[model samples]
Target: MVQHSYAVGMFPATLISLKVKPMNNQEHDEAVLHRLLFQINMEIADQTPKERELFSNSSSHFIGPPQRIAEDNIRLGLMIVLFLAGTPLNVTAMMRLRRSMLSSATPLKQLKQHLNISDLMILLIYTSSQIVWLITVDWRSNDLMCKLLKFSHALCFSVSSNVIVCIAIHRFSMVFGKSTKRVTTVSLWVAWTLAVATSLPQFAVWTVYRPYETATWQQCVSIWFVREYDIRTKNKTLLAEPLISSTAYSVYHVLIVFWIPAALLIICYLRLAMVVSKEIYCECECVKQSQSTPLTNGNMPSTDQHVTSSRRLLSRIISFSSSSSGRFEKALMRHQCVTMRRKRNAIRTCLLLIVAYIFCWLPYNAFFLWGLIDHDSYQQWHNTSIAFLRYLIVVNSVTNPFIYLPNFRSALCSSHAVQS
Candidate 1:
């Protein structure tokens, strides 16, 4: 006899029995156990460990598709174009600025010379790093090369930004403050120091690492506070971790690079505009007063000699007042006009450069910030927009020389001519 019992929830148990000829007890139990084990094995074999983990953890990141070959070619092509065009322009700018400095030691001339040097250094470092990446097909084989490229990129970018800020500040001081020459010289040194200090962390934050031991592809990526996972497979994964959290870094970059400099520039230019306008108004008023003033002579003579002498006396009085105030006013107006013209030219040059920088970098920073806040959405946007944004950022360096130097070419040439 065999008996089996089953119980349903919230109900009494029921027992059922079947009568049969006696069999081996051990064999009967062994056969039932084997059937249960087989069913469990079949269920377990249906799912892989990775699949099970994916199902369990809904928050895991999804990798995006790799960049297409055509995209890579297009990017490399654009970089080459930038190198060809920007390199010569930057070199020319540096040479012209050097020659100008040799002829004059004025504060304004010194500022231009420093600006050219900064731009030249930036162009050389940025272009060289990019060319290396293009030649090596993204530095797949050389770990040291990757690190050097990443470091140079960061350092040059920071230096460029800080140099622009210093330029703006110098212009602002020249218009609004006393002792501008000394202040500008001090600021230039400080700017270079700050740039180097800020960019030094790139060395610690970035490195070339093979995420998968079996894969041939190696990535230049940030490894600070990073957690790496190695999954052996044919598909390659691209993952980067930064020393600071993405949110923090994004905020810091936007604040330091864009917002602060932009605010300073706007304030400086607005004040300069006011000063220029005031000078114009005062000059106009002075002219109106001078014209309205009537000539006075104490004695009127009938003789032609006396008349001529009287006219000459009136002219002398007008030119040289009792306090010489009229003569002083004329001198002041001439000085103001020259100063205003110089300030206007400086403002125009700086404004255009600032606009170019903002236009090129704004989109890239916007997308970078968006990526940090919503990664899944970022992945979708990145496929379409990242290429263009990256190109714009790199292209800014190329566009800068044209914007800065072309308008000033005549001036540079004239100075060179005068020196000769």
Candidate 2:
């Protein structure tokens, strides 16, 4: 029987590096040999032995395995596609939003402009960094680059999440008839402040280091994982601290970056939908009342009666401005039609954004939490699923610009038509 070793994907823990030779081709099938090799490799990888004699320098050098290099190439191609696709969309969105700002200058428009800016930042910072990182696949830089890159990743997530929440809040206020000028300005400032503050912890957690002194491979990873491996043989029972800390940080990160923002978006959009639906129902009822003709004895009104009713209705409409309160009501009604249309469009656009956000991020965040729950099983399956989840996240950034851009342009055209 021939012996073979297969290195599966990116993570070291998923490496199937052990040579597997079946006892006899007839006695043990290829399936059994592969399964047996997988089990043995997984166990050895988990040990993370510190002794230089345990793992050879060639295998320890963190060079991309055939499978991992292939994956990196695929990832690099996809990143380029995303970057190429997203850059123009975001840039066009920014230009249109800027023009809209000059034309109308609403707070809600300002919030959307900023949201697009944040998405662009994510596309440029996170996606670009990912492309470079995949190309190298090994840490060719110092510790500062490692920490800075991690920090940039965290910063992108936080900023994007917070800006989305801010958009939801601004839209909510707009539909509810609240003044959003000061609110929007303050909320934007707070969003950036919170994002920076939350991401600062990454500087302390990540660093570039080799797995072993004799190993040629260097990686930028959480120090906790490094320390866990370094002291693994010293006290096996003391392993819980680093794992606990890492899990805690993961929980905090997910909450701030995804869970909390998701909750806020759901609540805000649901309330906005309810309020807009109620207003639409009420408007329809008013229109039905106004259009219905008066009837006598369940028969159609005569011409004289119809003429009288028309005269009375016209007189009432004309007299609507007689009092100060009546004038205010007339003024409000004059703008109600336009306001209602604007509100409906806002709700629709925001709903699309919310749906895109949930669809793209739900699995990613779920997998992140699952990894914290079952590290071993997560490591086993993450090699296959992680790339897809990350792609979904990048796709969200690409889709965001398209989501709002068309809606904004249509609204702008409608406004121009109304003016004309």
lDDT leader: 2
Model 1, runs deviating above 4 Å? 1-68, 138-145, 213-217, 224-244, 291-335, 372-380, 406-420
Cα lDDT listed for each candidate: 0.51, 0.64
- Model 1 earns a TM-score of 0.66
TM of each candidate vs. truth: 0.66, 0.72
What is the total number of backbone clashes in candidate 2? 0
Candidate 2 lDDT, 330-362, residue by residue in tens: 565556667678778888888888899889878
Model 2 ranges with Cα > 4 A deviation: 1-68, 212-217, 232-237, 293-336, 372-380, 407-420
Distance (Å) between predicted and true CA of 237, model 2? 6.3
Best by TM-score: 2
Candidate 1 lDDT at 29 equals 28
- How does candidate 1 score on lDDT? 0.51
